[model samples]
Every structure is written in C-alpha cells, then in structure tokens.
Target: MKLSDKAYEKFKHHLMMGDLKPGQFISQRELATMTGVPLAPVREALLRLELEGVVQIAPQRGIQIVEVSLRFIRDTYQLRMMIEKEAAAKFAGNASEAMISQLREVHRSVIARVDEVGPSDNLLKDAQGIDDSLHDTIVSSLGNELVDWLYAMNNQRIQLIRLAHGHLTLITPGTFRQVMTEHMAIIEALESHDPDAAASAIEKHLTAALHRALGL
Candidate 1:
C-alpha cells in the first residue's frame, strides 16, 4: 500500500479503536506520530478524510474528527438503506443456492449459540462477524466498485458512531437475538428468490438498526 493509504488506514484504525476521539483536535504532526507515518503522507490522508467528512481541516486550527449527531446517524442509515435494499433485491435474483444455504446455516448456528450460551465473548465475536459478513456479501453482489467504495466509507462512519455510543460492547441477549432473527428473515426472502421480499426485509432491518443506533 502507498504511504498515504497506510496512513489513512492507520487513522481509521485509531478512530474506530477509540484512540482518536470524535470532536478532538490534533495537529498534523500528532497524527503523523499516532499513525507512525511521515508528515507528508499524513497530510494527504487528512485531505482524503476531510473530503469523506471523517475530519475537518481548518486554516489555523488543527484537524477535528467528526462528532456523532442525529443528522449523521440518519444520513448514514438512509444511504445504507438505499444501497443495501437494492443490493438485497439484486442478490436475491443472482445469488447461488449454495451461498444462500450457507448463509442460512451460519445465521441459524449463531442464533442457537446465543440461545444456549447467552452471549459469551466468543459467541459475540462470532455474531459480529456473521453480521458483517451478511451485509458485506449483499453489498458486494451489486458488482459496482464505486457503490462498494461509498458503502465502505459510510460503514466506517456507522461503526465509529456505534463505537462512540457503546453499541459495540453492550450487546444484550435480546438485541442479539433480534438482529440475528432479522438476518434470518432476509435470508429466507433471498432463498425464496423473491426480490421484493428481500428488498422489503432489508429495508425493515436497516430501519430497526437506525433506531438502535439512535438509542431509540
């Protein structure tokens, strides 16, 4: 990877890992040190981040990380719904039967583990992976690199918001079950080859996720 891309990835890592906080201001040199990249690469990374709305660069002031807001939450989720619902519809029509079956089995396995163990660390980690995998699969099925890129950027912001709000570690049994069940619903629709049902399920699932992200 290029130094600037490395710097960008490192910056995102720190942001998601809570080392770099939202609304915090840091000089470019500080960012360089934090990312272990030189100042020039860090500057290039900051410009990209600024364009993505991940950070703001001011004239005399340092770079400021974006703080979570209601608008941000709504906008991110809205974009997710727009992209993912279409992806779900498309995936329902084109996804192989083997892939659909595997998705169903994995979701079922996670749901069973949650029921039996009540959210152990390992189970939670598995659940998080399952959650990410399902969405990633649906989005990648769209086969549009630009859309994929935009979805990834939006997903980073969504993850950052979730991390900031304690959503990552505070998974309750009920919440986990609901999420898995929602995934199963989408999977079922996909298996049935009903594009409309798949799209509707995705929309419903994303709507619930939006409410949860807003702490509703």
Candidate 2:
C-alpha cells in the first residue's frame, strides 16, 4: 500500500482500539509520532478521516474525535436495516453453494469455540471476521459497486463508533452465544434459498443489535 494508505490504516486502528477515544483531542504531530508515519501522509489520512465525519479538524484547537450520539446511532441503524434487508434477499437468491458453505463453516467454528476456556482475544477476532465476511459477501452479491462502497464507508464508521463505546470487543459468553445464534438463523435462511425468510432474519438480527447498542 501507499504511505498515505498505511498512515490511514494506522490511525484508524488507533481509533478503533480506543487509543484515541471519542471526543478526545489529538494533534497530527503526536499521531504521526505514534503511528510512525511521516507528517505529510498522516495529515492526508487525517483529512480523509475528516471527510468520513469521524473526526473534527481545527487549525488552532486540534482534531477532536467525533462523539457517538443517540441520533447518530438511530440514523445509522436505520440505513443499515434498509440496505442489509435487501442484500440478504438478493444473497439468498444468488449465493453459490461454496459461498453458503463458507458462511456455515464460520458459524460452526464460532459456535464450537463457545465451549472453550473463554472468549479469548482470538475467539473474539474470529467472531469479528465472521461478521465482516458474512455481511460483505451478502452486500457484494447485489452487484452494485456504489452501494457496496457506500455501505462499506458507513459500516466502518459504525465499527469505530462501537469500538469507541467499547461495544465492538464485548465478547462475554452470553453476547457471543447470542451472536452465534443470530448468525445461524441468517445462514439457515440463506441455505434454504428463501428470499423472504432471509430478509426477515436479517431484519430481526439488525433490530436486535440496534436495541443492544441503544441499551434498550
């Protein structure tokens, strides 16, 4: 990757890991030193993050991480619900056997680890990978480049917001099991090639997740 891309990923990782927390003030000089990237590339990365609405750039005050408000949560979930519901239906109709098998294996691996010692960091990372792959595969099946790009951008922001709130890494036994169950439901719907059922399952999953995020 280019230097600027590397810088962007490094900065984004810090944000996602809560090192640079929501509403916290940071300087490009400090970030450049922290990420070990040059000032120019770091500045470009910061501008890109600003365009994504993930940070506020100020000449004098310093960059402030964007706060995750209830309204932001509401609007984000609303948009996700609309796109994912449709994506699920399309995936049910078009996904190949191999694709279905890949999702099934991910689900099985996650469920199998639930009986392990604990939800270790590796386990949580596995679960996160499953979540990302499943959703991206479904969305990509729609064959709309623009929608894919848009959803990816929105999803990245949501992920960072979750990370900022410490929700992204919540891997308690209960939460892990709940996530496995929900993913299994969607996988079942897709395997059966039932569009309506797939859509309904996705709706239910996203709705429940939104409620959890809102602490409802």
Candidate 3:
C-alpha cells in the first residue's frame, strides 16, 4: 500500500477506536508527531478523511471530526444487515461440519473474553471483534474471496459507527443483553443448517442492533 494509505489506516484506526478524544482538533503536524511519520502521508490522510466526510477541513482552520449523526448510524446498520443477512443464508447451506466446529471454537474464545472483561468493558471493541469472526466465518463458508474483501472494506465504516456510538450506553438492562440473546439465536439458526432460518436470525440480529442505536 502507499504510505498515504498507511497513514490513512493509522489515523482511521485511532478514530474508530475513539482514541482521538472527542472535540479534539487534528492537525497534520500533530498526526506526524504522534505517529512519528513524515508530513506527506499525514497530509494525504487528512485530505482523504476530509473527502470521506469523517473530517472537516476549514479553509484557514484545521481538521475537526464531523458530528456523529443518526443518518450515518442507520445507514451503517442497513448495509450490515443487507450484506450479513445474505452471508448467514449462504453459510447455512454451504458451511461444512468442520467450519461450524471452528466457529464454535471462536465462540468459546469470545465467551472467555467476556468473562475476563466482565461484560461491560470495551463494548464496541468486543462487538466488532465478534462481528468480524461471525462475518468472516460466514463469508469463508461461501468461498467467495471477492465478497470477503468487500466485507472487510465495509467493516471499516462499521467500526467507525461502533466507536461513534460507543458512548450511547448500549449495555442496559434492556439493550445489549437483548442483542446478545438475538446473537445467540443467530448461532442456533446456523447450527441448525437451515438457510431460511439463518437469514431470519440475521435479520433479527440486525434489527436488535438498530434498536440499540435508536435507544429503544
């Protein structure tokens, strides 16, 4: 990848992790200082981020993070639902026994992390991690490298939304717990190896996520 792309990813990673600190101004010089890279790539990243609508470039002023809006959140969930529901359906008929077993193993690891983190720590990070595993498992089962690549690219935007919404308090007595329940339902559907059921389960899962975003 180009150095500019590398800088883009570094900044993007920190932004999506919510590590940039809210309401902070990001200058190209500051980025270079923090990342210890030179100026060119950092400037490239800033221009790209500006074009992507994540950053605002005032003519004489510096870059600021754009407001996290509901429309973007809804769009992210819509795309995730559209792509991942199809993936789940594909996996139901296409996943091998061994692949399912592998997914089960990944589930065990996730459960272990949840136990270690007490279910409330780094909620966005954990959700994204689980989403990655589930999505990758399904896409790989479909045996489509092109689809997998597309999914990865889209996942970056998803991560940004997750970070932006991380402070929205999802793990209430009513939200994340319900979301977890829906996720479990999805796993059950996949284990049953029924395409229609899997698709339904994914829709349910995505709907629950939208509820979290809606504060419902």
lDDT of each: 0.88, 0.83, 0.70
* Candidate closer to the true structure by lDDT (higher is better), 2 or 3: 2
Order of candidate numbers by lDDT, starting with the best: 1, 2, 3
Q: Rank the candidates by TM-score, best first.
A: 1, 2, 3
Who wins the lDDT comparison? 1
Tens-digit lDDT string for candidate 3 (107-179)? 6665566656656657545655666667667766666787776666556556565566754524442354565
Please give the clash total of every predicted structure, in order.
0, 0, 0
Which 10-residue span in candidate 3 carries the lowest summed lDDT? 167-176
Tens-digit per-residue lDDT, 69-179, candidate 1: 889888988999999999999999999999999999998888787778678888887888888899999999999999999998998788768767766323555588788
* Residue-by-residue lDDT tens digits, candidate 2, 1-216: 888899899988877776888778888899889889999998898888888778899879898888788887788889888999999998999999898998999788777775766788788877877877788888889999989878977886687657755563344555788877888999999999999999999999888888878777
- The better candidate by TM-score, 2 or 3, is 2
Winner by lDDT between candidate 3 and candidate 1: 1
Worst 10 residues of 1 by lDDT: 165-174
Q: For every model shown, what is its TM-score relative to the native structure?
A: 0.95, 0.86, 0.76
Clashing pairs in 1: none
Stretches of candidate 1 off by over 4 Å are 168-171
